[model samples]
Target: MGLLDSLEGMAASAMTNSGSDQAKVAGGLMQALQEHPEGVQAILNGFQNNGMAGHVEQWASGALQTATPEQVQTGLGGTGLIEATAEKAGVSPQMAQTILATVMPMVISHFAPNGQAPEQSQFSGLAGQLLQKFL
Candidate 1:
Protein backbone atom coordinates (compact mmCIF):
# COMPACT_ATOMS: atom_id res chain seq x y z
CA MET A 1 0.00 0.00 0.00
CA GLY A 2 0.98 3.61 -0.49
CA LEU A 3 1.94 5.99 2.31
CA LEU A 4 -1.40 7.76 2.16
CA ASP A 5 -3.17 4.43 2.24
CA SER A 6 -1.16 3.37 5.26
CA LEU A 7 -1.93 6.60 7.12
CA GLU A 8 -5.58 6.34 6.23
CA GLY A 9 -5.69 2.74 7.39
CA MET A 10 -4.01 3.62 10.64
CA ALA A 11 -6.51 6.41 11.28
CA ALA A 12 -9.44 4.18 10.41
CA SER A 13 -8.12 1.49 12.68
CA ALA A 14 -7.64 3.99 15.48
CA MET A 15 -11.25 5.13 15.19
CA THR A 16 -12.49 1.53 15.13
CA ASN A 17 -10.46 0.55 18.19
CA SER A 18 -11.35 3.60 20.25
CA GLY A 19 -14.44 5.11 21.81
CA SER A 20 -16.40 7.91 20.16
CA ASP A 21 -14.69 10.53 22.28
CA GLN A 22 -11.29 9.26 21.29
CA ALA A 23 -12.30 9.29 17.65
CA LYS A 24 -13.30 12.91 18.00
CA VAL A 25 -10.03 13.78 19.65
CA ALA A 26 -8.11 12.01 16.92
CA GLY A 27 -10.00 13.91 14.25
CA GLY A 28 -9.43 17.14 16.07
CA LEU A 29 -5.75 16.42 16.34
CA MET A 30 -5.59 15.71 12.65
CA GLN A 31 -7.29 18.97 11.93
CA ALA A 32 -4.93 20.81 14.21
CA LEU A 33 -1.93 19.25 12.55
CA GLN A 34 -3.30 20.16 9.15
CA GLU A 35 -3.71 23.75 10.13
CA HIS A 36 -0.30 24.09 11.68
CA PRO A 37 2.30 25.36 9.29
CA GLU A 38 4.89 23.01 10.69
CA GLY A 39 2.58 20.01 10.74
CA VAL A 40 3.89 17.06 12.76
CA GLN A 41 7.15 18.86 13.35
CA ALA A 42 5.31 21.34 15.51
CA ILE A 43 4.15 18.58 17.79
CA LEU A 44 7.66 17.21 18.07
CA ASN A 45 9.02 20.66 18.75
CA GLY A 46 6.38 21.35 21.34
CA PHE A 47 7.15 18.21 23.25
CA GLN A 48 10.86 18.73 22.99
CA ASN A 49 10.61 22.33 24.06
CA ASN A 50 8.57 21.33 27.07
CA GLY A 51 11.24 18.87 28.24
CA MET A 52 9.34 15.91 26.87
CA ALA A 53 12.15 14.96 24.55
CA GLY A 54 12.34 11.54 26.12
CA HIS A 55 8.73 10.89 25.27
CA VAL A 56 9.21 12.04 21.69
CA GLU A 57 12.26 9.84 21.41
CA GLN A 58 10.26 6.91 22.70
CA TRP A 59 7.51 7.50 20.18
CA ALA A 60 10.04 7.91 17.37
CA SER A 61 11.46 4.59 18.43
CA GLY A 62 8.07 3.07 17.71
CA ALA A 63 6.95 2.86 21.30
CA LEU A 64 3.63 4.20 22.45
CA GLN A 65 3.92 6.03 25.73
CA THR A 66 1.17 7.68 27.68
CA ALA A 67 1.39 11.40 28.32
CA THR A 68 -0.29 13.11 31.23
CA PRO A 69 -2.75 15.95 30.72
CA GLU A 70 -0.30 18.32 32.31
CA GLN A 71 2.38 17.16 29.95
CA VAL A 72 0.05 17.85 27.07
CA GLN A 73 -0.64 21.30 28.37
CA THR A 74 2.98 22.10 28.99
CA GLY A 75 4.01 20.87 25.59
CA LEU A 76 1.24 22.22 23.44
CA GLY A 77 -0.03 25.10 25.53
CA GLY A 78 1.09 28.13 23.56
CA THR A 79 0.68 26.47 20.19
CA GLY A 80 -3.11 26.71 20.18
CA LEU A 81 -3.20 23.09 19.09
CA ILE A 82 -5.06 21.90 22.15
CA GLU A 83 -7.58 24.72 21.97
CA ALA A 84 -8.12 24.22 18.27
CA THR A 85 -8.56 20.52 18.75
CA ALA A 86 -11.08 21.05 21.53
CA GLU A 87 -13.01 23.51 19.41
CA LYS A 88 -13.01 21.27 16.36
CA ALA A 89 -13.95 18.21 18.37
CA GLY A 90 -16.64 19.99 20.34
CA VAL A 91 -15.04 19.07 23.61
CA SER A 92 -13.70 21.15 26.44
CA PRO A 93 -10.00 21.99 26.35
CA GLN A 94 -9.45 19.86 29.42
CA MET A 95 -11.14 16.90 27.80
CA ALA A 96 -9.13 17.38 24.67
CA GLN A 97 -5.93 17.46 26.68
CA THR A 98 -6.85 14.24 28.46
CA ILE A 99 -7.70 12.36 25.30
CA LEU A 100 -4.78 13.80 23.41
CA ALA A 101 -2.52 12.22 25.97
CA THR A 102 -3.45 8.94 24.29
CA VAL A 103 -4.06 10.05 20.72
CA MET A 104 -0.74 11.88 20.36
CA PRO A 105 1.30 8.79 21.04
CA MET A 106 -0.68 6.78 18.53
CA VAL A 107 -0.18 9.48 15.95
CA ILE A 108 3.54 9.59 16.50
CA SER A 109 3.77 5.84 16.36
CA HIS A 110 1.94 5.83 13.02
CA PHE A 111 4.25 8.41 11.55
CA ALA A 112 7.33 6.84 13.04
CA PRO A 113 6.76 3.23 12.13
CA ASN A 114 10.40 2.83 11.13
CA GLY A 115 11.83 4.20 14.33
CA GLN A 116 12.19 7.72 13.01
CA ALA A 117 10.07 10.79 12.54
CA PRO A 118 8.37 11.11 9.19
CA GLU A 119 9.17 13.86 6.73
CA GLN A 120 6.81 16.82 6.93
CA SER A 121 5.92 16.19 3.30
CA GLN A 122 4.56 12.78 4.20
CA PHE A 123 1.84 14.28 6.34
CA SER A 124 0.54 16.76 3.83
CA GLY A 125 -2.49 14.71 2.91
CA LEU A 126 -3.16 12.81 6.09
CA ALA A 127 -5.29 15.39 7.86
CA GLY A 128 -7.88 15.51 5.10
CA GLN A 129 -8.14 11.74 5.05
CA LEU A 130 -8.47 11.54 8.82
CA LEU A 131 -11.04 14.30 8.89
CA GLN A 132 -13.07 12.54 6.21
CA LYS A 133 -12.87 9.22 7.99
CA PHE A 134 -13.43 10.33 11.57
CA LEU A 135 -14.99 13.78 11.77
Candidate 2:
Protein backbone atom coordinates (compact mmCIF):
# COMPACT_ATOMS: atom_id res chain seq x y z
CA MET A 1 0.00 0.00 0.00
CA GLY A 2 1.01 3.61 -0.44
CA LEU A 3 2.32 5.52 2.58
CA LEU A 4 -0.89 7.49 2.86
CA ASP A 5 -2.87 4.30 2.88
CA SER A 6 -0.55 2.86 5.45
CA LEU A 7 -0.98 5.88 7.67
CA GLU A 8 -4.71 5.78 7.27
CA GLY A 9 -4.63 2.18 8.35
CA MET A 10 -2.53 3.08 11.31
CA ALA A 11 -4.95 5.80 12.34
CA ALA A 12 -7.88 3.51 11.95
CA SER A 13 -6.12 0.88 13.93
CA ALA A 14 -5.42 3.37 16.67
CA MET A 15 -9.03 4.35 16.87
CA THR A 16 -10.03 0.73 16.77
CA ASN A 17 -7.53 -0.49 19.36
CA SER A 18 -8.61 2.36 21.58
CA GLY A 19 -5.29 3.14 23.24
CA SER A 20 -2.62 4.26 20.80
CA ASP A 21 -3.05 7.81 19.66
CA GLN A 22 -0.02 7.94 17.39
CA ALA A 23 -1.92 8.45 14.16
CA LYS A 24 -4.12 11.18 15.59
CA VAL A 25 -1.15 13.09 16.92
CA ALA A 26 0.82 12.59 13.75
CA GLY A 27 -1.95 14.03 11.63
CA GLY A 28 -2.64 16.86 14.02
CA LEU A 29 0.98 17.76 14.49
CA MET A 30 1.68 17.67 10.78
CA GLN A 31 -1.34 19.80 10.02
CA ALA A 32 -0.40 22.24 12.75
CA LEU A 33 3.17 22.46 11.52
CA GLN A 34 2.07 22.92 7.92
CA GLU A 35 0.00 25.87 8.99
CA HIS A 36 3.09 27.68 10.22
CA PRO A 37 5.67 29.16 7.86
CA GLU A 38 8.35 29.03 10.55
CA GLY A 39 7.24 25.72 11.94
CA VAL A 40 10.48 23.84 11.58
CA GLN A 41 12.46 26.54 13.30
CA ALA A 42 9.79 27.01 15.91
CA ILE A 43 9.83 23.34 16.80
CA LEU A 44 13.59 23.18 16.90
CA ASN A 45 13.62 26.24 19.09
CA GLY A 46 11.05 24.63 21.35
CA PHE A 47 13.24 21.59 21.75
CA GLN A 48 16.22 23.78 22.46
CA ASN A 49 14.45 26.08 24.85
CA ASN A 50 12.85 23.25 26.76
CA GLY A 51 16.21 21.49 27.26
CA MET A 52 15.27 18.63 25.00
CA ALA A 53 18.17 19.24 22.67
CA GLY A 54 19.77 15.99 23.72
CA HIS A 55 16.54 14.19 22.95
CA VAL A 56 16.58 15.86 19.57
CA GLU A 57 20.07 14.51 19.08
CA GLN A 58 18.67 11.09 19.82
CA TRP A 59 16.04 11.60 17.13
CA ALA A 60 18.74 12.87 14.77
CA SER A 61 20.76 9.74 15.48
CA GLY A 62 17.71 7.54 14.96
CA ALA A 63 17.76 6.25 18.51
CA LEU A 64 14.22 7.48 19.07
CA GLN A 65 14.17 8.60 22.66
CA THR A 66 10.73 8.58 24.18
CA ALA A 67 9.37 11.93 25.13
CA THR A 68 6.65 12.17 27.75
CA PRO A 69 3.35 13.83 26.88
CA GLU A 70 4.26 16.34 29.54
CA GLN A 71 7.58 16.82 27.86
CA VAL A 72 5.96 17.31 24.48
CA GLN A 73 3.54 19.70 26.04
CA THR A 74 6.38 21.62 27.63
CA GLY A 75 8.53 21.42 24.55
CA LEU A 76 5.78 22.90 22.45
CA GLY A 77 4.83 25.45 25.11
CA GLY A 78 1.77 24.06 26.83
CA THR A 79 -2.01 24.37 26.43
CA GLY A 80 -2.31 26.57 23.37
CA LEU A 81 -0.20 24.22 21.34
CA ILE A 82 -1.94 21.14 22.68
CA GLU A 83 -5.35 22.66 21.99
CA ALA A 84 -4.32 23.47 18.46
CA THR A 85 -3.22 19.91 17.87
CA ALA A 86 -6.42 18.59 19.48
CA GLU A 87 -8.51 20.78 17.23
CA LYS A 88 -6.74 19.51 14.15
CA ALA A 89 -6.74 15.87 15.18
CA GLY A 90 -10.37 15.98 16.35
CA VAL A 91 -9.24 14.64 19.68
CA SER A 92 -8.95 16.06 23.14
CA PRO A 93 -5.90 18.08 24.17
CA GLN A 94 -4.92 15.24 26.48
CA MET A 95 -5.07 12.84 23.57
CA ALA A 96 -3.09 15.24 21.43
CA GLN A 97 -0.44 15.33 24.14
CA THR A 98 -0.28 11.56 24.29
CA ILE A 99 -0.08 11.24 20.54
CA LEU A 100 2.60 13.91 20.21
CA ALA A 101 4.71 12.09 22.76
CA THR A 102 5.03 9.31 20.23
CA VAL A 103 4.78 11.05 16.87
CA MET A 104 7.24 13.91 17.40
CA PRO A 105 10.24 11.70 17.94
CA MET A 106 9.42 9.58 14.92
CA VAL A 107 9.03 12.63 12.73
CA ILE A 108 12.30 14.16 13.92
CA SER A 109 14.12 10.90 13.34
CA HIS A 110 12.63 10.58 9.88
CA PHE A 111 13.72 14.07 8.91
CA ALA A 112 17.14 13.86 10.55
CA PRO A 113 18.47 10.46 9.66
CA ASN A 114 21.99 11.86 9.31
CA GLY A 115 22.19 13.15 12.88
CA GLN A 116 21.59 16.77 11.96
CA ALA A 117 18.43 18.75 11.60
CA PRO A 118 17.55 19.57 8.05
CA GLU A 119 17.49 23.17 6.91
CA GLN A 120 14.11 24.84 7.08
CA SER A 121 13.60 24.72 3.32
CA GLN A 122 14.51 21.04 3.15
CA PHE A 123 12.36 20.32 6.17
CA SER A 124 9.46 22.16 4.62
CA GLY A 125 9.50 19.92 1.57
CA LEU A 126 9.88 16.82 3.68
CA ALA A 127 7.25 17.97 6.13
CA GLY A 128 4.86 18.50 3.24
CA GLN A 129 5.40 14.93 2.17
CA LEU A 130 4.72 13.73 5.71
CA LEU A 131 1.60 15.84 6.00
CA GLN A 132 0.36 14.45 2.71
CA LYS A 133 0.71 10.91 3.96
CA PHE A 134 -1.62 11.55 6.88
CA LEU A 135 -4.12 13.56 4.88
Candidate 3:
Protein backbone atom coordinates (compact mmCIF):
# COMPACT_ATOMS: atom_id res chain seq x y z
CA MET A 1 0.00 0.00 0.00
CA GLY A 2 0.96 3.63 -0.51
CA LEU A 3 1.66 6.29 2.11
CA LEU A 4 -1.88 7.59 2.14
CA ASP A 5 -3.28 4.09 2.45
CA SER A 6 -0.97 3.36 5.33
CA LEU A 7 -1.81 6.67 7.01
CA GLU A 8 -5.52 6.07 6.49
CA GLY A 9 -5.19 2.70 8.10
CA MET A 10 -3.25 4.15 11.00
CA ALA A 11 -5.72 6.96 11.36
CA ALA A 12 -8.65 4.57 11.41
CA SER A 13 -7.06 2.51 14.10
CA ALA A 14 -5.73 5.45 16.15
CA MET A 15 -9.07 7.22 16.48
CA THR A 16 -9.46 5.87 20.00
CA ASN A 17 -6.48 7.95 21.02
CA SER A 18 -7.14 11.61 21.64
CA GLY A 19 -5.30 13.95 19.30
CA SER A 20 -4.94 11.12 16.79
CA ASP A 21 -6.97 12.37 13.85
CA GLN A 22 -4.88 10.45 11.37
CA ALA A 23 -5.97 12.05 8.13
CA LYS A 24 -5.74 15.58 9.42
CA VAL A 25 -2.45 14.80 11.06
CA ALA A 26 -1.11 13.27 7.87
CA GLY A 27 -2.44 16.19 5.86
CA GLY A 28 -0.85 18.58 8.29
CA LEU A 29 2.47 16.82 7.83
CA MET A 30 2.19 16.91 4.04
CA GLN A 31 1.18 20.54 4.27
CA ALA A 32 4.28 21.32 6.31
CA LEU A 33 6.54 19.51 3.88
CA GLN A 34 4.81 21.12 0.92
CA GLU A 35 5.13 24.60 2.35
CA HIS A 36 8.85 24.02 2.63
CA PRO A 37 10.06 22.53 -0.65
CA GLU A 38 13.39 22.07 1.07
CA GLY A 39 11.75 20.28 3.97
CA VAL A 40 13.70 17.05 3.67
CA GLN A 41 16.98 18.94 3.84
CA ALA A 42 15.61 21.15 6.56
CA ILE A 43 14.63 18.13 8.60
CA LEU A 44 18.07 16.62 8.20
CA ASN A 45 19.61 19.92 9.10
CA GLY A 46 17.43 20.11 12.15
CA PHE A 47 18.59 16.70 13.25
CA GLN A 48 22.19 17.62 12.73
CA ASN A 49 21.75 20.92 14.48
CA ASN A 50 20.17 19.16 17.40
CA GLY A 51 23.07 16.69 17.68
CA MET A 52 21.12 13.77 16.23
CA ALA A 53 23.42 13.01 13.33
CA GLY A 54 23.21 9.27 13.86
CA HIS A 55 19.43 9.40 13.77
CA VAL A 56 19.59 11.59 10.69
CA GLU A 57 21.76 9.11 8.80
CA GLN A 58 19.63 6.22 9.97
CA TRP A 59 16.51 7.87 8.54
CA ALA A 60 18.14 8.47 5.17
CA SER A 61 19.32 4.90 5.24
CA GLY A 62 15.66 4.00 4.72
CA ALA A 63 15.83 2.44 8.12
CA LEU A 64 13.43 3.35 10.88
CA GLN A 65 14.98 5.54 13.54
CA THR A 66 13.01 5.64 16.72
CA ALA A 67 13.08 9.20 17.97
CA THR A 68 11.22 10.43 20.98
CA PRO A 69 8.45 12.97 20.69
CA GLU A 70 10.54 15.44 22.65
CA GLN A 71 13.43 14.85 20.29
CA VAL A 72 11.22 15.54 17.29
CA GLN A 73 10.00 18.68 18.97
CA THR A 74 13.56 19.83 19.55
CA GLY A 75 14.66 18.86 16.07
CA LEU A 76 11.97 20.95 14.46
CA GLY A 77 11.93 23.67 17.08
CA GLY A 78 13.85 26.26 15.10
CA THR A 79 11.50 25.94 12.20
CA GLY A 80 7.99 27.06 13.04
CA LEU A 81 6.82 24.39 10.62
CA ILE A 82 5.15 22.26 13.24
CA GLU A 83 3.27 25.22 14.64
CA ALA A 84 2.27 26.18 11.14
CA THR A 85 1.07 22.67 10.49
CA ALA A 86 -0.90 22.65 13.73
CA GLU A 87 -2.65 25.81 12.63
CA LYS A 88 -3.29 24.44 9.17
CA ALA A 89 -4.81 21.27 10.56
CA GLY A 90 -6.60 22.96 13.43
CA VAL A 91 -4.79 20.74 15.85
CA SER A 92 -2.75 21.66 18.91
CA PRO A 93 1.01 22.13 18.51
CA GLN A 94 1.70 19.35 20.96
CA MET A 95 -0.49 16.99 19.00
CA ALA A 96 1.18 18.02 15.77
CA GLN A 97 4.54 17.33 17.38
CA THR A 98 3.40 13.94 18.54
CA ILE A 99 2.06 13.02 15.13
CA LEU A 100 5.24 14.10 13.38
CA ALA A 101 7.30 12.12 15.81
CA THR A 102 5.39 9.05 14.87
CA VAL A 103 5.11 9.63 11.14
CA MET A 104 8.24 11.49 10.00
CA PRO A 105 10.50 8.47 10.26
CA MET A 106 8.12 6.46 8.15
CA VAL A 107 7.97 9.20 5.55
CA ILE A 108 11.75 9.47 5.33
CA SER A 109 12.18 5.74 5.08
CA HIS A 110 9.53 5.35 2.42
CA PHE A 111 10.78 8.18 0.28
CA ALA A 112 14.34 6.94 0.50
CA PRO A 113 13.64 3.31 -0.31
CA ASN A 114 17.03 2.99 -1.98
CA GLY A 115 18.70 4.34 1.15
CA GLN A 116 19.47 7.63 -0.49
CA ALA A 117 17.63 10.90 -0.67
CA PRO A 118 15.93 11.68 -3.94
CA GLU A 119 16.78 14.59 -6.19
CA GLN A 120 15.14 17.97 -5.64
CA SER A 121 12.50 17.46 -8.31
CA GLN A 122 11.50 14.08 -6.96
CA PHE A 123 11.45 15.45 -3.41
CA SER A 124 9.28 18.36 -4.44
CA GLY A 125 6.57 16.06 -5.76
CA LEU A 126 6.20 14.03 -2.59
CA ALA A 127 3.69 16.23 -0.81
CA GLY A 128 1.56 16.76 -3.87
CA GLN A 129 1.50 13.04 -4.48
CA LEU A 130 0.48 12.38 -0.91
CA LEU A 131 -2.26 14.97 -1.11
CA GLN A 132 -3.48 13.64 -4.43
CA LYS A 133 -3.61 10.15 -3.01
CA PHE A 134 -5.35 11.55 0.04
CA LEU A 135 -8.06 13.09 -2.06
Candidate whose TM-score is highest: 1
Q: State model 3's lDDT.
A: 0.64
Taking the tens digit of each residue's C-alpha lDDT, what string does model 3 give over 2-51?
54455344343333333445456666665565566565667767777888
Global CA lDDT computed for model 2: 0.65
Give the clashing residue pairs of candidate 1, or none: none
lDDT tens digits, residues 32-98, model 2?
6645555555666677788888887887688876889888877788425567768866889888888
lDDT of 1 by residue, 1-135 (tens): 664455445555555566588787786676666667876778878888888878877877767778899989988988899998888667899999999998777777676554355675667454544445443
Cα lDDT listed for each candidate: 0.72, 0.65, 0.64
TM-score result, candidate 1: 0.74
TM-scores, all candidates, are 0.74, 0.69, 0.69
Where does candidate 3 stray beyond 4 Å?
A: 1-20, 112-117, 128-135
RMSD to native, candidate 1: 5.2
10 residues in a row with least lDDT, candidate 1? 126-135
The 10-residue segment with the lowest total lDDT in model 2: 11-20
